[model samples]
Target: MSGTAELAIDAAFAARLFDELAARTGDAPGITRAAYGEGEQIAHDMMIREAQALGLTHRIDPAGNLYLTYEGRDPALKPWVVGSHLDSVPHGGNFDGAAGVIAGLCAVRALIEAGLRPRRSITVMAIRAEESNWFPLSYLGSRAALGLLPAESLSTPRSDTGLSLRAHMSRLGLDPARVGVGQVHLDPAELHGFIELHIEQGPVLEAAQVPVGFVTGIAGSFRYRAARILGEWGHSGAVPRGHRHDAVFALADLITALDRLWGEVLEGGESATITFGEIGTDPALHGFSKVPGEAGFCLDVRSPSPACLERIHAGLLHIVAGIEAARGVRFNLGARSGSAPARLDEALRARLAAVAEGCGAGFTELASGAGHDTAVFANAGVPAALVFLRNQNGSHNPDEAMEMADFAVGADILARLLARDDND
Candidate 1:
């Protein structure tokens, strides 16, 4: 272990805490800590206990974000915050959200053990409701913390229990109305920078044999919720190929066109990804004997470059138009949900790179395919960055392998970065 790791991170403690939380929340498939549910609440309570044990003062923000604060020499200075969420997707791995929070806590623990005080406070926060699986929202806690999400989003009904997020909060004894408006607990202006350490959640680092990686930016994405194709219902066998306006066939053509568009996007030397996560015909109208009258699907497109995203989107629209004319079907690409790309602070990246080098930790720079809470802060002009720890078996599933050594190295890097008073 390097000086930072030795002084700042308690690797054993972090590992133990991870195991304890996993055991408490683990189920047959994987860990289950639904947002605002029993598991999430238990995880939060455990975090509070740990913070108290470390002699740190903790508070719950109006948005239900838990912040454990290690006071610094100047309490009024904007805090350098580091943390990740505690809630998990259904059947998610133990380390997905938990590792980041534990890493932040361990980093702070190391600093306290070393009896070091920086110019600004360091806060470790375990954010809530990062996974959209529970509710129809992503980054709810972070966005609400920043006052970026609308108040109406709080009242949006969850898919599982058919209760609004507000109702769920009420069940947890939190005021939903108060939670929607951010800045009640901590001002966004009071944040110096944000650092989130998360499992790679992909095979990139493992394949490259790197222990850690720095995120360049978060991918911007476009989502179509009700993309549909309308055609006349007819017999599957009796309808002639030329006479039938088959919706399913039109959907297939659209997918093929999108794939061609994807090829063109690659030819332009821009990275882009498109997914048709859902495709279905109306069950009442769709049968083995009938030609499908209507089809519905969801399209998700993402890219690190806004230009590339728009380029692909334009291609999609063009394909829809062409398909509609060729197949005699009406294509309805419904309302889109869009988020612009967020680039990490270059200065902060430089600092992290230097710190990682000093710690002798092997690292590489990459852009995150998945979105994170860091993007919300970074988009709002805050200095925000992500550090990805190596993991196997991917994330949002069981058997997510995050070795303690790798976890310690990541914590060491973050601790050293936070320990710096160079800019202050």
Candidate 2:
């Protein structure tokens, strides 16, 4: 253990930051930090101001990812990067993405206040556009920084504004062309490791009665955002059951079949999740007395196991074929988008676990069901670890509640980890 283990995390600093964030970005029902929008800009600016106050060097990439570095004894060693994204889902809780960034700041602040600098620098990152609700892309800022995002994605439009990503970057005076050409800002090989501290976003930590969790892996997903089922419309009273070709009934059959497959997968001791997040018929065309002719839906399937993901996808195709043949419906599954599962660095995880144990913070190992920017780093060949703070009422909603005490415990662990000398 490092001498900084005796130093306490600056939790008060984190509280003030969180309160200020909520006040400035509050969106009535909750907070709305739209990706690359005004609210998100406010967050980045705030982080910059805080970095300036801490006397840390700051830099911004072409994609507007923020990096604030606290200098250490050695300038040549690869820095330890700590951070998470700053954008949130529409009307989302205040803590979902912001907590991780704040935790990074808190950890760095603690080290600085203790008058101790380790061998390698510590960089607190503020990633952007993590909420796919705004940009329809995964790990937008992180991928851009690591030069992993495809050039075609630059033309993808924001959901609410319908403006291309390139246009948005230009609006903020950022170089979209550089990002599109795969300019690297934070190279994976130049970092010692990456650590992200985020809220649990689920009941797992709370149920386990632990204040924090060390994540083992993050779930990958396959998504169909604009799938549709088409069939002939007819009068409900006139169409016989055998003769009717109903799109709604066909959708129902598809859902039932998928549900059965999901249950079977679970019974087989495999982990997977299937969700029909959005499903409905066209309100303008359908009537109460009419048999629906068309229905649209979106599907999101996730699993930590790549083989399991493939198995489920295969079952879905088979089920869709049978449903189409029996109901005489045409299925149009739109462009598929997804990411592969990520495995965290086991050695780094063990080190953090030891640090947490030394700090007397209760923690357990688990796998994350939600996607995060940490997965981007792990996929880029960087050693990465994710720490989850206990939160209540789930996440991506206004009711999410993470205790400040729990956050302090997590931050303390991070501070201890960063304050240790490389030789130790």
Candidate 3:
């Protein structure tokens, strides 16, 4: 609505898109939607529609990533790609990934409506699985696009559920090998820059009274699912003190040990967190599964830097192994998901900051506390930047939002960044 300055965005379109996104989130029939479900497809369709309405060329990657391209002055240039994921964590807010996608769409709207054309083409992509429950890790689609996708991901199992990613892809008519790494020509601009507009998904910016932010770099994640203990379940009241194996009790011991090591990690000020985030017992018994069976649970050991995570992982695994041995619990440690820390494009960051200043959008430099698809480009050697909007504390919940005015400012900044030759 601000008729485009050097760079501007359509606040009205962004708000409309956000509302539409909320509508699409539950358009399909289910309480929870995983990566390849019908719900995700519906979500993908809504994004495609927005792109079509904008008159941008549209396509979906073999991995189900949706891209809406806006032609620049030179139609031949590899476009400056923007936008984020459309998937959400189980009950996540509609705005987390959705806002960024809309922001990208609005970027183009602002540019075209402002009656400006650039040397580089522009694209808004709604990548898949950034919040995937099926992949068991983040950034699957973008990694594939950047050629960093693991060869083994196709056969990788999601938890103990028998579904393999390969099978899911097959069902969706996608061959996993070619998913994120498809036919887009990485033109001059693409070689140098990539920008993503996303909600802050945390309380910091809004609480600080800032309307926008220039991200320093996104933090990395290092985690291995810990099957730290395996114990036999027995009759609760009948099991003798030393003669029986109470698997839950041993798991409790392991959890406490993990807590202590986590305390040490917190004390180091390295932005580390070790969460026993999820768990599964032998049976979901009403009151009795008294067969004296097995017990298990998961552990999430994560940190922003790969180095710090590695150190913490090594020490914690050692301590956990020790706990397993000492507490009469058996251990079956599972494999770890490999992670790379992303250091954002500095030149892009500076340009974005300048854009924020020009737009009069108060902003702060910060780090992304969550995993994002932008890291895929960083891991694959592309210059990438993230623009974060404000959200209060409710990530992975139903109440996420980006203030209309704040989102508009961030969009303007993103447009400027995209329009600049700002990559180093």
Best candidate per lDDT, number? 2
Encode model 2's per-residue lDDT on 393-421: one tens digit a residue.
Answer: 89999888999999999998898888888
* Residue-pair clash count for candidate 2: 0
Report the poorest 10 consecutive residues by lDDT, candidate 2.
1-10
Candidate 2 global TM-score = 0.98
lDDT of each: 0.86, 0.92, 0.70
After superposition of all CA atoms, the RMSD between model 1 and the true structure is: 2.3
Residues 1-424, model 1: lDDT tens digits: 2234447577889988998988999876888998988889999999999999999999886668899999988898889989999998888899998888999888888888887777789999899899876775667888877777778788777767888998988888787777666444556677899999999988999999989999999998888867889999988788899998889989999898898888888888888788898899987767888989899998888899998998888888888888888889998887777677889998899899998888778999998988788888898778898999999889988889988999998998888887777756
- Tell me each candidate's TM-score: 0.93, 0.98, 0.88
Q: Which regions of candidate 1 deviate over 4 angstroms?
A: 1-8, 181-184, 282-285
* Distance from true location, Cα of 200 in model 2, Å: 0.5
Model 3 / residue 356 / CA error / Å: 0.8
Q: In model 1, what are the clashing residue pairs, if there are any?
A: 8-110, 234-291
| Local accuracy of candidate 3 as per-residue lDDT tens digits, 148-205 | 5667677766543578877777788876766433434233235546788788867779
